[model samples]
Target chain A: MPNQEKIRVNQLTKVFLKHKERVMALEDINLSIKDGEFICILGPSGCGKTTLLRILAGLEKSSSGEHQINNSGTDRPLQSMVFQEQGVIPWMTVEENVSLGLRMRHAPKKLINERTKTYLRKVGLTPYAKLYPKELSGGMKQRVSIARAFANDPEILLMDEPFAALDEQNKFILQEELLSIWEETKKTVIFITHSIDEAILLSDRIFLMSSQPGTIKEEVKIDLPRPRQMTQVRSDPNTAEIFLKIWKHLQTEVQESRTKNER
Target chain B: MEELKKAVEVEKEDLRRRQRSKKFKQILTISSPLFMLVIWEFLSQTAIIDPRFFPPPTTILQTLFSMSASGELFEHVRISLIRILFGFLLGVIPAITLGLIMGMYSSVRHFFSPLIMALMPIPTLAMLPIILIIFGIGEFSKMVTIAASVFFPVVINTVAGVMNIDKVYSDVAKNYGANPKDFFMKIALPGAMPVMMEGIQMGQAIALLTIVAAEMIGANSGIGYVIWMNYKAFLIAEMFVGLILISFFGYLFSLLLRGLQSKLIPWK
Candidate 1:
């Protein structure tokens, strides 16, 4: 059998009309993902990284070109999104928020309950399941968000800067938690981030994007071993070389965007 | 260990002081109205202010008691409350549903925005004449006028509430496999609740105001009508009794609203 892709985007472009001004958010963005492959799209702020993810998530439409996801698993949800802010939904209790995706899809009572309980425990939010998002701290809220996404059992998980707002300790803890969860299910994950280290730590491959009319500039494969730790990235001689390469590519793009903005 | 104990003692002392201060504030709040009533009583007894207009608190209390005994106060309050209940529900239910729909769909908003904007500025009392002309001096007119008054504040506030909900929430709903019904129920309704509560409270306040004005102008059997009749007859104490009853009910309803708000939007 031919190696058919799980998700394929062909010349996908998005133009946002703001204040009657044409703003090209993404220009000819094309990418493909295999099933269960963790991919990260790295870019600076306002680089349409979020726009690209939104299109893939079906929350926004591309202006030109087609984006398609071939879901062989008919019952599983096509995609589930983890947003950077208020993702767990403040109005819902942790358990309710965690079960949102499943509930939305009309999943049965027993499966919803079992999955919610399991995921909440996996995210260390079992004690907080009955609490509202407002009552929980930032880290705990994100844990609920993460748990909700995983519990849905979607074919693909699209996370947009899920840890960008957290403090270092919370970010690292959640990142480790995310890795643990992802390792088990290994659902195709597309994570968008500005942090180079986050991309290196989480993704099997990094798609480096440039700012002006956001497009993929480079794709660097990360052959880092599974069961990875943050400390391991520091010691691995290969990681430094990869980090420098990504940094150089991103640094130049950022500088170029800054210069254009000044003009 | 000694330092830790000292720290604990300090914290306890601080908490006690805070509790004491909070108690003092509550006492002050309760006593301020009574203090004013006492002063008013003293002044009225001395005939400092005309007893004809500013009757003594004791006389007003007697008026209240006599009205209660005669069952006139109960009849008036009951009729007015019935009007308010009907009018409030008539305005609020549709207003909220349409407001949420408007918030979700801009085309619906566009169609209604001009109509609401044009209608909102005209006072409910101003429409009373037209309402009277159409429905005549009946229960329907008073209720309709009150409903008009109750409608705008709730609809506008609810729309604002729904519109101001974080965009990310709806996006999250769409990204997941949430159907349209799920979006409406799970996302929009609960998300708009805190602001919608504001609209409902304002609706209640206006409903009270409109019902009073409406009863005084058009109806024959309500608290407002009784107050107006007492004014015509120069029964100053009875009018004061009516005013005091309105104040009491207003305070009670506000407390009820606070309880509902806390129950529904505990996260807020």
Candidate 2:
């Protein structure tokens, strides 16, 4: 059941009209994701990692090819996305923002209340639940986003650099919080990040992508033990090895991209 | 422990500074206008200025007090208030509805944007002649003109408010599988509300200003009528009473609106 195929992408392509010129953002992205697998799409800037995630979230249509998220549960949503910024609605209170996904789906009151309570507590936001998102710190707002994503109970959670804006301390804490929740819920999550260490810490597999015609360059399976803590992951010998691998791959691509732009 | 004590002392000093500043501000706020009123009373009592045109503060206050006691001011204020309230509701309801729709749909925006652009420039008072021709110089004409004034500001702000909602919110809502109804009510209305409230406030001010002109030009029963009648009869003090009353109500209504705005969207 753990290895059951939850997502499949076959030769998926995305082309964008930037200033009226057709630029290929993602070309023939193909991947098979197992149920409950944690995926990190690692890449340099403009590597089409976010575009792929947005496509999966159904926010944008793929130009060609196809992808599918198998929703086995009758009523559960297929997916929910945590945006990199402005994820929490400013006008809504923390409780309201967290309950947005469930309430939008018109879930029963008891279920909404129960899940909202559970997630709020899990994210350590029980005390701030009644406050508006505007009153919260940047770290706290991201907590609301994470809680809302988990509380939705979607088959898949798509996070596009959810902790990228956080400082080291807050990011480390939220990353741990996310990992613990993922371990308990066993939900499929595809997190996009540029930080090699972060990808190593959270991912079951890292999909390295190349720039320009963004395509999947390599897939690295992480054999790190479950329940990862930041300190232990940083100290792990294997982590350093994998970091070097991703860094080496990313270096050439990023350099080529910067040089090409310089021309 | 030394650092903690230093921090607490710093905090106490900051609080004291803030308290002193707030007290100074309070005193200045109450005294600034009172100071002006006393100077005006002094100048007018000594006949430094002609009392016929520029009446003393006491004379205006006496006129206001006399009119209120005789129930004449009450009648004029009541009629004017009713006209403004009706006109505001008539303008706000339609403008808000159209604005929300126009904001969400580009086709609607495209169609109406030009029309609004062309029409918004024409002064609401300038339309009074046409309004009088159409509605025939009664309470209806005054209401229609006031409504016209109220419409533009509310609609423009409402549209801008809705259109300015962050794109990320729409993406998040779509990902969550929100239906159209939920999108409009939860996202569109509330997202646009803070800006929309600004429009509503502006609309209230324009409505008050327009209602006076409207009553002076057409209706015979409002505060504007009293002002015009007093001016014609050379009752300058009575005219000052009407002007003062309008200003007082404008201040009162804006305060009420500010309270409503805070209650409605405290998050903003």
Task: Give each model a TM-score.
Answer: 0.96, 0.96
Q: What digit string (tens of lDDT, one per residue) describes model 1 on residues B111-207?
A: 9999999999999999899989998887887888888898998899888988999888888888777887888888888889999999899888888
**Which lDDT tens digits does candidate 2 get at residues B70-127?**
8978999999998998989889999999999999999999999999999999999999
Best by lDDT: 2
Q: Tell me how many clashing residue pairs each candidate has.
A: 0, 0
- Chain B TM-score of candidate 2 stands at 0.94
- What TM-score does prediction 2 earn? 0.96
Q: Relative to the unseen true structure, what is the C-alpha lDDT of residue B222 in candidate 1, on a scale of 0 to 100?
A: 90
Regions of candidate 1 where Cα sits further than 4 Å from its true position: A1-4, A18-21
Query: What is the C-alpha lDDT profile of model 1 across A1-263, one tens digit per residue?
Result: 02458889999989999999999999998889988889999998999999898888888888999988888758888888899967778889999999999999899999999999999999988888888888988888888888899999988899999998899998988888899999999788899999989999999999999997899999999998998899898799999999999989989998999899899
